[model samples]
Target: MSSNRNDLDRARAAWRWRGQQRPDFAVTPGPGQESVWDYPRPPAYVPDSRHVSVYAGDTLLADTHCAMRVLETGSPPTFYLPPESVDMAQLTPSDRRTFCEWKGRAEYFHVTDSSGRRIDNALWRYPDAFDDAAPIAGWFACYPSQLRCFVDGEAVRAQAGGYYGGWITDELVGPFKGEPGTGHW
Candidate 1:
């Protein structure tokens, strides 16, 4: 099948699966943190100030400033944000790195904050990227499950799904593609 056909099929299948999802739907927001139901997002991705975190069993993960918005996806909209908002004192640099054809090369990290909190390379950033996404340069981001959320010192959570990154958010939606999302995106 052509790539275009595959994309369309994937889109349709996702839409159907979403509409047919069980009302008792469940998802893991972070390690050992599971929640029921889905989170709603706005259309056309409105840039807004947000906060998010990554945690491991009641432990505070990394918290950072963010921008949240819903993007077009059969699953759910994803929130995107900048790295400066994140406190890198908790992250450890990892040799692991990859590249996005459109975004450019990305570097990863294993996190351990100044408070000694830990979350392995659950965060990533594109040191250099296309001009369009350049605003996010140097801004690190983490998966919802990798960390927890605390916006304005208030604890918040996200919808269940491994396919999302709540940038500038803790209640972000999905489906997000990390690995293998490369090649002419």
Candidate 2:
């Protein structure tokens, strides 16, 4: 309802505050490494076959062998999993929604465990992605900070700052966008 929308708006405003200097956390990408600074502006979706899994403490919430990774400038890669690979029964639709210029409207989901523990609005998806991002339609992406997210058995560090959901791992180098003073990046 309006309250949820307002909350979502407030959250976005807090995270998207403008002003900054791009920091120097970007490292020279070595063999088998990717520098987030080198990512493209409109973002690019690359099919990823690496196994992806999400857990709420000891409870398995999602597991997938197929995923799509979005690489955007100044941000770590974000992996999107097909809905079939997630435990849809444990997720309830949330009233919150957000707009992504390239991805269209993103609907939020609250994750819950059978025991009733829940993480509010921690997952999201673009039911109708813009043409440039259509590859991710019907896919879901989680905030690693809200749950344990893994790629090929490696736990991913959550991208700092709550607004953008990107997965950070040894394979990537930053100053990523979510950190302090990166609003303008």
Candidate 3:
């Protein structure tokens, strides 16, 4: 007799097989492909069926239900989702830029409330990512102070400690791959 584990695996395999047929819109670049001097990135996004993520600071902050992608731009790998996942009224642009070899250049934004509280530049987006990863042209990342993280409507903490801005998922394994490990990976 086969266990439910086999049934689950079959279902997952079927789903994954179906997904590969479609062209991936995300413009994610493979490692070492980025020009550290030029710094432009287009990325390949791994699709997340469980797309709703949020960051709340004692309030109802960002919330959305769509596909999610991880940006590998030599900075911090950030969680990027469709803009519709977040309420536009609560966000604003911030004057911050981080340099990345893989993803090109990045710009940041902050969230605010009706009460006039500022969240600072807790979010970011790559306006024009590099060649391999361009589908995520406008999605943003939430910095540590601006919001807490949640995926698939579940409240989750960043696996990466002290990574206020960078969002962590099953795919983008780090803390050992990059800094904190002194770039050994």
Candidate 4:
């Protein structure tokens, strides 16, 4: 386990874009917009007071004016809603688990709508987050691809792939990391 952890640490250290410099392909943010490239590598836990909401079809799954945005370089922000704002009954633990060197292990959840429609692994949380990521310990982040998500009344577009959970709002500009051929980014 220690060997695997060390290997993960090494891989995390090897990332090319750590937000010190933006790649040529990165989009420059217009007035109120933010460039994902400007975010940090270890990610910043930004407290966002904007109204964020998630819906599984027509059923509301989560809603909050207080949320945390995990801002990482090369990716759009992933909004994490506090547990108190989420409808816990709609989520069930999923078998899928993933590790983030910066945040520690993440556990997935399957979100189900009132109509019984289920979106597997539609949400995730870091129950035992690393020291730096401790603020989001019980917060949940949903995939916009699997559910409808909004930030301050603006609809969110899912970051270009199935794996990444970044929520792209109109105020954010990016040649985000999850797109095809961007595996190296």
Q: Higher-lDDT candidate among 1 and 3?
A: 3
| Top-down TM-score ranking | 4, 2, 3, 1
**Per-residue lDDT of model 1, residues 36-132, tens digit only:** 1243211233465655454544655445455644443223334445555555566679988765433457788887755666667677776775464
lDDT of 4 at 181: 81
Candidate 1 runs further than 4 Å off: 1-46, 51-72, 75-77, 113-117, 150-185
Pairs that collide in candidate 4 are: none
Candidate 4 C-alpha error for residue 144, in Å:
0.4
Which numbered prediction scores highest in lDDT against the true structure? 4
Worst 10 residues of 4 by lDDT: 1-10
Instruction: Give the true-structure RMSD of model 1.
Output: 8.6
**What is the TM-score of each predicted model, taking all chains together?**
0.51, 0.85, 0.60, 0.95
Better of 1 and 2 by lDDT: 2
Evaluate candidate 2 by giving its C-alpha RMSD to the native, one decimal: 5.5
Error at 73, model 3, angstroms = 11
What clash count does candidate 2 reach? 3
What value of lDDT does candidate 1 attain over all alpha carbons? Answer: 0.49
**All candidates: CA RMSD in angstroms?**
8.6, 5.5, 15.6, 1.4
Clash pairs (backbone) in predicted model 2: 25-174, 25-175, 26-174
